[model samples]
Target: MTTDSLDLFADQPPTPPAPPDDAGAEAGDDGTLALDRYAERAYLAYAMSVVKSRALPQVEDGLKPVQRRILYAMSEMRLSSSAKHVKSARVVGDVIGKYHPHGDSSVYDAMVRVAQDFSLRYPLVDGQGNFGSRDGDSAAAMRYTECRLTPIAELLLAEIDRGTVDFIPNYDGAFEEPQLMPARLPFVLLNGASGIAVGMATEIPPHNMREVAEATCHLIRHPDAGLDDILAMLPAPDFPGGGQLISSPEAIRDAYASGRGSLRLRARWRIEELARAQWRVIVEELPHGV
Candidate 1:
């Protein structure tokens, strides 16, 4: 009899196993992880990092990580209002090298914003060169600009070493920085803050220092004071641009009570007659965000 016929199919290798549902992910020692679960965890970690380390301003100091770092770096260099101003590049270098460990442009941009009068109700940095303009002009390069801390900034840093606040290690653990500046007053209310983080945001408009102080005093005297009583001392936001708020009193009251509301703002402008029959408009002040 003839030998059993060879089967070509029998010699063929078995089909390779199918890939996991998450084709992009590689197998780990633990087990296969769903793509969605991995993404969710990554997103959550990134969001928390931004909220805590970069985006939001601390309620205690009313300064974001970058801003606080710049101020602290300046203070360490003794760049006070009365001190001789130094090249902004120098400050930026120190900040990146010692504390912030970020891009030079970002650090310089934050410094410029702190010096811009139009950007803050009370500017915290004293810039000697073109910092910026309300018309959207950018500041000069760091090498060309010089800066120092404003007198008011001293209010935030003066007691830093008097045991008023806690200090923590910097990024490389080579230096120490304050956890939060010991501001005498609520700088958050005075300068106002606007930042959008991963899931939450803030849009606090600046208020008059006198009004805030009076309201604070009222609260201290009458701990149970009603919102109406507080409002009497601090009626509304006092923007640096000096625009008129057209929102009704009722609307303002409701906003404060509910912690959510919008205010209508009107720019202050006037007409100036030109040489020709045409007249030009001169804007005296702009709305808060403008």
Candidate 2:
């Protein structure tokens, strides 16, 4: 052989193969477990819980779980529009103890929202005291406030005893709650809803009662009527706050057709003429949710 040169600096030789892995031992290690499968299942379960049981409102009744519980509890307590208003705390207690097994504040908040005219197109709870304000005021303590369901709410609960909806057992199986309310109107479109859930969300704008009623009647008369016919009766959203919907006709029509669109709403204002050729802008109405 020719004169061979010894390489002084070189990588170490590869180590011999380790002993064969024990299948049982490998399985015992957390690293080898099917983590992705378990994680996926857990994520899906939590997502469904948020979507179906909590965040989103049911299309049939337009009420979230908490809202539905509040209404049903009030109905059970005979807190009708004609009846005298009861302390909000009492209703909250009934709701928590019977139908909803949640915190007192959350239930009370939902009840307050149902009462606030600025929040709902049609106030469901006829609140006697300070429920809240459009200017960002928190509602008074539940103990201080009094509330009874409004006449509009009566429509939702009137047919409960007549088997208009199915009932299911409450959290502890101590009570039964209706699956959905027997709504006389399509409350989903009437009051509108905005909710965020797993991978999806909904933002339905409130419509005028008369327009919605007319559209409902039209649909009932002609089940297969086109969107244009329906649009003629229900032209655009009518928010609780009276403001101008400045969106063009084409945009409005597109929104109705595609089921996804944005609306441009501006506060109603007018220029007031003052002395010495001075003028000032006075805002009459604000956009909804402002």
Candidate 3:
């Protein structure tokens, strides 16, 4: 057997077989009912593993592993500031091989989503060739698409080499991993998040960068300001795709006061006239599931 397999077996302890189908098992000495504690413990361990490793976002970094890998892969490709674009296939291969260690299709899908301006209020990717659209169209094949990082991404990744964050050994100890991201902006609010876990979940809405920043500054200056004061600075969520926040004025006030609530959003459309034709296009829309 391989060394790794031997090690795995060595770490495991043998379990006792259960009583035969017709046999009545005796209770433990302490009068406790017989139970498969080992199995229960194993199941609980697996659940906690999934929750810690997948569902919950790391508050320090404001990103999951896949998201971090995508940004780093873009930086490694030298696609930050240069006009030269790399094929999406190249990016996918790099991320899968060097960082994400996941299927190429999923990595490519995330890449396209990050590039779509309509999906993100501030897209972190600058893509060429069809990267998909807000109407739920699939992006072109990796070979047909080209990509690079946007200026905002550049700012986020720049701190990686500056020793501002921590790095540790990866799962296999064959590579290093970033413990957290030194994000210049509050990206959690900028892009928002939605994730599910055992007995828990989170749903956050995207907000305008300018408005959020202004509100943050105001809060800093007047630490004791009430919810109304903060709401005065940030009237409502301003989406990049130019949409109206449809919640009642009172609803917004309540949300800010309670620190939680849902907001309604609607798309904004505009009509354009050409020399021989007229066209209607949606200029803006609220973030999905707002």
Of the candidates shown, which would achieve the greatest lDDT relative to the real structure?
1
lDDT of each residue in 1-290, candidate 2, tens digit only? 01122221111222233323443343445655355655555565655666677767898989988899999999999999899989999999999899877779878888888888888899899998888899999999998999999999987888899988999999899889999999999998888887666655777888899999999999999999999999998999989979899999889989988878899999999999999999999999999989
Find the 10 residues in a row with the least total lDDT in model 2. 1-10
lDDT of each: 0.83, 0.82, 0.69
Candidate numbers, best lDDT first, in rank order: 1, 2, 3
Clashes of each: 0, 0, 1
lDDT of 1 by residue, 174-253 (tens): 89998899998889889988766667666777889999989888888999999999999899988887999999999999
Relative to the unseen true structure, what is the C-alpha lDDT of residue 99 in candidate 1, on a scale of 0 to 100? 92
Query: CA lDDT of 116 in candidate 3?
Result: 85
Per TM-score, the best of the predicted structures is 2
Residue 153, model 3, lDDT: 82
RMSD of 1: 15.5
Q: How many backbone clashes does candidate 2 have?
A: 0
Off by over 4 Å in 1: 1-41, 271-281
